[model samples]
Target: MLTLHPNSNQDVVDQSLPVNFQDFIKSEFHDMKQDLTSISKDITSLRQELQDIRIAMGFINDEHNKINEKIAKMESKFKAFDALVTTVEHLRTVNEKLEADCNAKDQWARRSNIEICGIPEKKGENLLRITEEIAKKAGFDLKMTEIDFVTRVSSTNKVNKPKPIVVRLQSRYRKDDFLACLRKLKVICQDLGFAKNESRIYFNDHLTKFNKMLLQRAKVLAKERTYKYVWVRNCTIMVRQNDTSPVIHIANVDDLKKIK
Candidate 1:
């Protein structure tokens, strides 16, 4: 049984109010602490995710740098390769020019010689006497002293033909005059006492192997194009459409384009 006055009741009510307020403060503090702990967990998870992203970015950057390095190396190699190709082309051009010069000099050395073809080869043939007989038939006064030497050379092809005779003359003028006279006469084997053979004797300027090949090419091209003439003079390859046309000189393989 509790007895209270009106002021005493007010004092009890005031004391109970403090206890309720303390309980309310404690509950709010607990809720706030839980919220702070949840926030800390969320921050830790974000930090780990950020660390993963940083690692990924670092790997990508390193790979990008490596790719750049490889690209730079490839560019350098390409430049060096281009330079090497240019040098090789220059050397090739120089070598071809030198070879042409050497071939020209070789042909110049053989200027005073004549090549005779289609003459039957006799086992005990006196080439000089044969030459003299041919000159006599052509009505040319070819003294024995004017001749330097005469020899039979093997044919360049595998065909079964007699070896040709190459005659060196002491004077290019004499050789030219003899060739002119022989061409005009159009002599044959029969003229040289080979009664059974009727093959025409052919006389020509002595040419280097290079010029000979060039002449053959020019002849074939001329025949294909219906050109009237392809002749060699002084080791030069000449082409003509006809007697009235201007002559074209062929100096190299590149000149084949001029045929058209």
Candidate 2:
């Protein structure tokens, strides 16, 4: 039995105890089963989401690998192209050097040779006899035995365009003496009863095709740049700015800048 005061603040309450132990255990077990069911559903959903994430990661990794492969191939191709370009450049440089050396050797072969131009050609004309005649006329006192080789050079058979005579002297002394006699050609023409300017004979060192082009180019540059003289000496193209200017030996076309 209980007694309550009139001003006491109280609420309804259940003061009961478990009277059936087996029934309570069954109820508790049922609640736990429900909770476990919900947890199982959540765990299944989590596994699905993890699978999706794994698939996405695999796709990204595959794409990354493909991109890397492409980049590697491009790098390989670039290296090959670079190597090819380097080889071509090297071959071109070597070829140019060989050509320059060949031209130099060819010029050296013609070092002791001289050429006579403006001399008219005739049938059965003896070149050695004519050389002696010209030398004697120029007061050179030259002999026929001083000549090593003599020939007329003509690329075409046109008789009006007479070819020059090429002469290889037996000695450098004769070569110098031959050139000196050529300088006095005006005297030779006087002795031969020809006009001063009518001799029409010119003497020069025999030059290779390359050196000839070099001389031609140097002459053009000298004229265009107003140089005083452009001449060939010992198969070399020479340029001078004035009478007393230092002689510039033109070894190649690049040397044209000296006159320019």
Candidate 3:
């Protein structure tokens, strides 16, 4: 057994303790450095992602502005189109009124004329002689010079029938008087030396092509509604339900609705 001093034992313990503490401090410092490096790398990645998000937001904002501009342009075009449509409709109404006025003037020009229907046509027949014969049968004192002209006109109907005689008198008053006499006499084809044909002759105011069509429509509608009178006066279509009923002037196809 060896004897040892207390001071020497204390000095040895102090030297070993210093070496252990130093090693522990070095290990903790190295671990701290590694943690700081990892935190720095993570911060750098987060910054890059934030920058990318900002760039994407800028692109989206630009697209939104472009869409707004396109919508504004479309709205303007639609407004312009609506205005154009209104203008066209107004023009159409004006054009229709002008055409109606022109037609009225044309019809008024033929006021002094008379249309004779149900008269049999013959080759080389004298129209003036036939007209004079009609006046004689009706007991009307009509002179040959009172007639300005007489001619056969083509029928507007599709059926193959005798052409009607159109007579333009020198005076409208004379034409009216002659028509009234013929109506009162109720002259027929047989009275005019057509012994085989007995169809009653018809005397009417000479109407334009348009007025003739309108008159036909008025006659059909009046008959359907049990109207007693449908006739043309001075090229104007007239309709009456009865003797006491108010007369209706039919100016166009739309007037047909007035019957009911």
lDDT of each: 0.85, 0.77, 0.83
Model 2 agreement with the true structure over 217-258: per-residue lDDT tens digits: 888888888898888767778899899889999997678777
What overall lDDT, based on C-alpha atoms, would model 1 receive against the true structure? 0.85
lDDT of 2 at 225: 83
Give one digit per residue, the lDDT tens place, for model 3 in 221-256.
889999999987667788999999999999877888
- Name the better of 1 and 2 by lDDT: 1
Worst 10 residues of 2 by lDDT: 9-18
Model 3 weakest lDDT span, ten residues long: 9-18
Off by over 4 Å in 1: 1-56
lDDT of 1 by residue, 32-111 (tens): 77898999999999999999999999999999999999999999999999999999999999999998898888888888
Residue 235 CA displacement from its true place in model 2, Å: 1.7
Best-to-worst order by TM-score is 1, 3, 2
In model 3, pairs of residues that clash are none
Q: lDDT of candidate 2 vs native?
A: 0.77
How high is the lDDT of residue 43 in model 1?
98
